[model samples]
Target: MSQTIHINRVGLVALALSLCANAQSPQERSPIGAVLGTSTPVEELSTKASPAVVHIEVSSYRTSADDGDEIKNQTLTKRQGSGSGVIVDPDGYIITAFHVVKGARRIRVELDRRVRANSPAGELLNGKRRSSFEARIIGVSKEADVAVLKIEAQGLPTIAFSESNNLKQGQLVAALGSPEGLRNSLSLGVVSSVEQQIEPDDSLVYVQTDVALAAGSSGGPLVDIQGGMVGINVFSLTQRGREEGLGFAVPSPMVRFVYGQIRHYGFVPRPYFGVDVQGITPTLASALGLPTDSGVIVAGVGPGSLAQNEGLQAGDVLVSLDGMPLQNVPQLTWLLLHKHIGDRTRLEIQRKSSKIVLDASLISEPSDPEGSIATIDIEENLVAKLGIVGSARKHGTAGPSPTASGPGVLVVARLRESDTRAELAAGDVICSVNSVPITSVAQLRATIESFKPGDAIALQLERKGKLMYMAFEMD
Candidate 1:
């Protein structure tokens, strides 16, 4: 009886051990197994996503030296700049930073994880050494700073798309690209906010994030948690020309919009305005018979422009466009962007002591006039490019009064690299050349040619809406 009881006990122990083994076995493991149940980290998504990202290189040539002789030959020199790009389709269509391929003599696209070279990761570290796939420029919009390219290849991996609409503030975001020419570099951050407008023109709609975007990351995709692209890593707030932590992105919806327009129209659908405007102060609004603290004051309208065609004139306070209230420049930009060309909208205008309404159809601004004419209008490009600008008139407007103000000339616009922009402002009429009266571009050109590179000229001009004489030496 004792032997039988001991055997029974051993059998019971063996049964329990077998059950445990069956529960933990690969075949049984409750279907998931311990390893399979683990969550995947975000880096895995970046790894797969990086394969679709590409680096674009462009080369160009420019005149190196020019001789004063009209018929003399000039030497040409090579110039180069870099930006980021991504593969959007399996058909070899690539999207990249427009400024990158702009004016490029040649363009080349490099796949991210092409080959493992001399480095420990067996990957080619130097992008300049690796072979680049040739690409053709498809479309470009500089104001939006986006471009599209096409190459000859297939079976390329494409990133999944995510909507910025669903992206929440402070959600994690990742950036993958060859930032600063370092291949396969990854940086992580969070969505700082949504709908941030950082452009000086206030025309661009952006997704502001805390992602680290360097010079080379300009066109890289901003990835959300699901590895889907939320935005394209773009400009960052800068101080003294150096980057601050605040990074901005072109939202994915805008990216898709840009791509669609480029594919369909071969150019961006930029909105236009024919009316000159300035922010209205409370005092100014009251004087103009408008409600204080509302809308932009219409200073003038361009002849034969969309505004003039719609019967909009000077002294009309623009209160709104369409059904949307126009509180500021950005508000107007947003409203116009919602509609396309040929779309008609009603505008609320306060003229004299009565409110009026008018309908206008949006149209594209005409291309800049060709040829170099002295009286031709040049927009204030110097403020963004040269850090200084000089306009020929007050308010940057043209009229018969400006031509008759003074014959010498005028520095109507200036971007101050010095004390203040007002120190050398627009309305300042240019007079005298070495204490000589001058008029017209021809006289100004002749007087300037007579002096050497480092010569001084006595000048007289207006300042603070009052005429003051001052001298500026020429270089």
Candidate 2:
């Protein structure tokens, strides 16, 4: 999303509060009263910021076959979900949590009247003053839990981003979202912590707040008193599905980084060294006969990977990357996250009392083996008939390197409904058609061309971790 500062809502609010405080100045005030200084209140900030927030509703369609009956007809199931988003660009670019739209076949966004510059006064002829618009997915990064969406509108209200790194603990913050499908709801809290680890080993962190967030609040904006957005509301710690006042958000820096990468590359280009590593503590270092008390130990190097090609092997203790010392797995992971594909970096490794320095190039990590399927481009006629879009999975592409096994035509995206009764989904691997194995896009196209319209065809698909058979008539 592009940056813009049209209204300067936060600045205006701050200025107004400062003037009010000056006007109410006194010769002396109680210590307690001084400590509890008043600025822009939560209600005022919520009202000023609510224009940029939007309600998001999504519908996902999936095909379910009868119990133990593959040849019979299938049923299409619709699952509905709701969340919130903030307009970051007046040109209709929206930022929201990835989980809100994951696997969704259709997405709709509702904007309040205030978002429109020329909207009417505060008058509600109907229940609410809102307008619905169809939203399209621009890109998504599941690892960062951020997704960018686009709606067909212009000159919409937007929220300003705050420097989350400067956020202090106990600072007041407000969360705005559609909690429990209630639009424009507000919650108040303070920053409990700025560095909260989600993974046990990774260095990734989230901003922790004491704000109580509900199910529909995910992807909403966490704003400061001045109405600047500092974080994205994500999830809350709960006991028995009850709120615990322990909410977490993806800090603004990470949100900006992920959003920029997705917008430019269509996906997050996560660099990979193709090596599994573990942190080596002092005790483990002594047992392994290592020189340093802290470092990262390479457990296994992938076959034919850059690590293997560069002579990196199991049991090699990585001491540093480039010039930075890596004392643990998190440090190494953090360093790798900043690197891009084709980036060459020097690595200092210790092997059996011998210190060695080697250079290795990074490559994009391959898609998850269990979740992603190889994609191939089929004939235009077949694509139009099937209402789908796909691309042939290339070998040794710029993105994540593919594994040795599970080579087949991958389904990239599923389009709208067609007359065909076949059920195919994104990330599904089309292994074969009519029992004929398909290895490439050309093969899939040729196989589909062999069958005439109205012919019943059997498709062998690999979804998630299971193999299933689907039968549909060609139309």
Candidate 3:
């Protein structure tokens, strides 16, 4: 089973204050006048920012007939998801994190109250509003983890973009999102740092802030005091795999890049290199007799790839791209995705005893150039976690069972001595794992990884119209 992470929404202010008051007695309470000074009022910002924020929900369906299962039936299931989005146009286009509505079959939008509907109080509140709308996925950038959505609603309020280039460290900032299930939540903090690169895969310039964002805050806007959006909150710092208060956001430049592509072309055209690279450390470079702190070492180039055709070979050190110094692997990857195909780029590198320059034309994904740009390779680690590889059944499903069809993931390759292989036959169709429906390879792995070795695992399989239970040790 694979590991899973989820976000939670924060409660409303009145409820939070009530909870705090309940924790204390009358004597422990502070004077109301003194408490005002301790709090920085954000009501004005909230009133303006809430209109630009929205909630998203999605649903999907799967059919057993598609999986080749004997059941030959169909099942409909709806998945609900919540994330923050910024209205980018008066015509109702929205921008959000890609993971928010990935694989969504249906999407629904909820705008601030009082915009088109009466406030919950119904007192003809002038500033309070709530409106419901429908939305659809317009485009997605898997490499950049951004998605654009559009709505039919007109005259929508939009947020203004500020120059992230001028953002300074230690400046005050606000994070607005639906944290822990509460909508239109706001938190205050200061910019901790700027342009701090933390991950090799995170090449988009970022602004690190000390905002107290909790779960369900991804895709929220990080705004300056003037209420202009400077960045989009994406993720938080995790030490030893645990989340900390320090959060990071995508700077306005990358946001504008993705937004422009989606607005003009309806999709982001990511440049593909068809090659994999490994970082070169100073010590390793010295030992290899190469200039220290210069270039990456090509590990593998895909067959018929742009890099392979351009004479990019393994063990070569990549020093620069388009004459700009390449400090790390992420910088190179960013350059590749930063433009469209037909854009020419240059690579400077060292091969063994000599330096050379390679000029190349960027290309789209070979098979589906306009599809998702995420590189696809068999994840051995992810497969090993499942202990079973499934092939789409000739007339059945290849995924885990109990999915309205029956149990067991179709067996493509079963690891030797695996528990499932011992109790169930190779060709048998598994319907359930201890009564849980098996859906995809991901679902199978996630379930298995949730248990430890020596844990009891059970399966229900169908072989020739007879259902049987096979029990085994997880290890």
Candidate 4:
């Protein structure tokens, strides 16, 4: 009976194939063929979104030998990496993962955007013309692994962003990327879990999916059936040597928020809450004599901060913020993220036995000094060797630099592509170069040019009221 059943199943499959082969007209074709034909929704969605999707190639330097007596001296070797990005602006703003371009000395974008003589950027080509452009890092948020890039082109294709708030578990999503450097590959999968915290105590959340992701997949867009971007593919959780089904993406909302902040400030504004809080577990609540088990407790309050100014103290159990119930640490951070600097909010905490309410406003730490690099003079401020626009200033005048006293060069801006082997950021005050005091922009430039490639240089930097040192090789 089993043999007979197997024979019948094979005969049915053969009959179906013969019928499909015999069909020459559309009307005679099988419904299955038509359903899976060239005009399917998936195909249409891919066609609509693939143009805006781009392949990102990054180049950075790494040491040939990290450790061992056999290799006492480390040599710089060029390393290449690939990832994916989506065009968010027609004027050439692309968004990708921070890891894709971090520590990269050079970044290049490969897109299908039209490259006409007068075209904006990538234009749909006939596989004949090359559409590649060098991109500059606009800003990056390491916490979320989102980075924004800018290319010098216009009329570029861009993808539309859809609200991810309503995404349900088991919803269909497609990932577009160049897995293993195979460009324009698309895979389909379902949302495994909406909220996934890969790390403990991390305030960031990811959109976990069962989507097929590989090495070259980071920074790609995870879109819905309608070709709307829902998330950016970040990483995959692999066990041993297999990738059965574990992928994660930075949620669209968080990416969008970071993008907006970076575009304006050239960095994510660090919100200074002046207070630290943790979740109130059952044990913690009982020990603290709190009323409820599920809540948040103030761990510490910064001195001279608005929290302390408004009577917020340690051991205070926070009940709500602006009437919204507080539960965990992530939720508190998320809620506070919605509040920008100067935004006033109401907080209710269970202090001792009474319910006390405190009203306070939010503030932020000093923004990235690179944000003010605009409109710099080309001739005087530009330090080509170090790739920074600088100005001379007195240390104790602006803010006392305990290490230095008189004149130093203030870094107003930094160019992404430079031979400098270290991260000499804007807002850093250069106190000296290799024990030789640097007073002005000319002195900084001259002192830097005095050293040649392979020479080691140490710079004393004053950043955010602290003195530190940055050392690197001249390349």
For each candidate in the order shown, give its overall lDDT on alpha carbons: 0.60, 0.71, 0.63, 0.73
For each candidate, give its TM-score against the true structure.
0.59, 0.70, 0.62, 0.69
Flag regions of model 2 displaced more than 4 Å: 1-24, 27-39, 61-77, 117-130, 277-297, 315-318, 327-334, 350-355, 369-408, 411-475
Position 262, candidate 4: lDDT: 89
Best by TM-score: 2
lDDT of 2 by residue, 1-475 (tens): 1111111233334334443464544564533343244423544576678889999998853333312436333323346889999999887889999878765667899886455432234434255443677788887776667888988777688998988888888666778888888887777677888877665344457899877798999999988878989999988999998777789998898888877887887767778677887767677778878877666788899777678989999989887899898766655765787798899999888899798999988877767421121111123313545454445555333233232225566665554445556677756667678888777766787778778888989888766546788898887
RMSD in Å for model 4: 9.4
Evaluate residue 206 in candidate 2 and report its C-alpha lDDT on the 0 to 100 scale. Answer: 83
Best by lDDT: 4
- How does model 1 score by TM-score? 0.59
- Candidate 1 residue spans exceeding 4 A from truth: 1-40, 61-78, 114-131, 199-201, 240-243, 271-273, 276-300, 304-306, 314-317, 327-331, 334-340, 351-353, 368-475
- Please give the ranking of all candidate structures by TM-score, highest first, separated by commas: 2, 4, 3, 1
Ranking by lDDT: 4, 2, 3, 1
User: What lDDT score is found at residue 437 in candidate 2?
Assistant: 75
Query: Tens-digit lDDT track for model 3 on 31-129?
Result: 333223333234445566667877665552222322355642222123466778888787778888776665455667777553564332443324544
